[model samples]
Target: MTDSLGQQKPVNIKALLQACRSKEETFKALVTLSKTLPRLSAEKKTEENKVKGCESAVWLVVEESHGIRHFKADSDAKLMRGVLVAILSLVEGKMLADIQKMDLKAELAELNLSSYLTSSRTNGVLAILNKINTV
Candidate 1:
């Protein structure tokens, strides 16, 4: 669905965050979303644009128009792809400053994902933020 600004709106981040806070719900949602994402294929993969610090290979592409930022990402890992979807859904088309100000760590913590994420996956998340910041 589109928001008032006519940009695609995400599945509600607040609701997702809350669900993540509940162990059973978070696991269920993650599993469901992860299953839904298409797996990365050799033909679809790009080398140069791949995120550097992730344990699992991840590629993120960004586009901006009229002050709105859009992102497309793919990952070799299903769970990571789901995480990317969750993050992108929250920030896509949002103002840069607002995106920058977002307490992603806190939000993830609320979902109990903060502690479970690998250092590499955390870095991948930061890489996404850096990409958005640059746009």
Candidate 2:
């Protein structure tokens, strides 16, 4: 898969899962990627759209253009922001069918996010997936 920037993007789920498994590298990668994402606007993030069950308030907005989905998200907590970035990096610019087919629970487990995350944060991850499904 390729992005709007003409860069070849990782489409294989296993490769992305492996990338997220490296704690140090994935953390750095997330932070760097987050810096490049467009900032979420206040209008784009309404109370109703805020991800529920999250320890920190998180907002995710999904937009589809030319048959590809693009995600933009923000969070009050830095770590949550990194987690969102990591997840979004894997999904964004992909077809909805591909996103829907992904085994997110297994992928998260492979990344060991469940072990590192709190119960609320784990729920927040599910909430993100729910939102994606809705889109």
Candidate 3:
């Protein structure tokens, strides 16, 4: 099935991130992406799902089938929601071994994302990544 982005069922999220030339362009893309991404239900955004270090409320749910992991996430803040979706896009449907081996920090650095994020936001993203790794 096609996702909201209307490309193909299998999207290359890394390629999408790599396409952004600068931090400003990335944020602009996030604003547009926020409008298109599907959100989690209110019930699913409970304290249990909350990402611990985020300034805004964020939730992530991971489902695994056979060998692939599926991730669903949401955030109260629109920009944060977009950030979560961008992060999720990178790892959703990945196998456990691939997920563990992936260097998310490297990817973020390549995207020049740290220059645009506050310490809290960085920690929050790390917390989300940690959760994904352990799952």
lDDT of 2: 0.70
What lDDT does the true structure give each of the candidates?
A: 0.66, 0.70, 0.72
Candidate 2 deviant stretches above 4 angstroms: 1-36
Off by over 4 Å in 3: 1-16, 19-23
For candidate 1, write residues 1-135 as lDDT tens digits: 545433234556446646565656666666665554445456546766677777788887666778777666778777787677666767777677777898866655554555447787788787766765665
Better of 2 and 3 by lDDT: 3
Pairs in steric clash, model 1: none
Tell me the alpha-carbon RMSD of every candidate: 3.8, 3.6, 2.9
* TM-score of each candidate structure, all chains considered together: 0.72, 0.74, 0.82
Candidate 3: give the clashing pairs. none
Q: What is the overall TM-score of model 2 with all chains considered together?
A: 0.74
Cα error, residue 120 of model 2, in Å, equals 1.2
Per-residue lDDT of model 3, residues 68-89, tens digit only: 8888787778877767666766
Q: How do the candidates rank by lDDT, highest first?
A: 3, 2, 1
lDDT of 2 by residue, 1-135 (tens): 446633225443335435665666666654654454556788978986688878888998888899888877888777677677657766878889998899877666655455447787788898888888776
* Global lDDT of model 1: 0.66
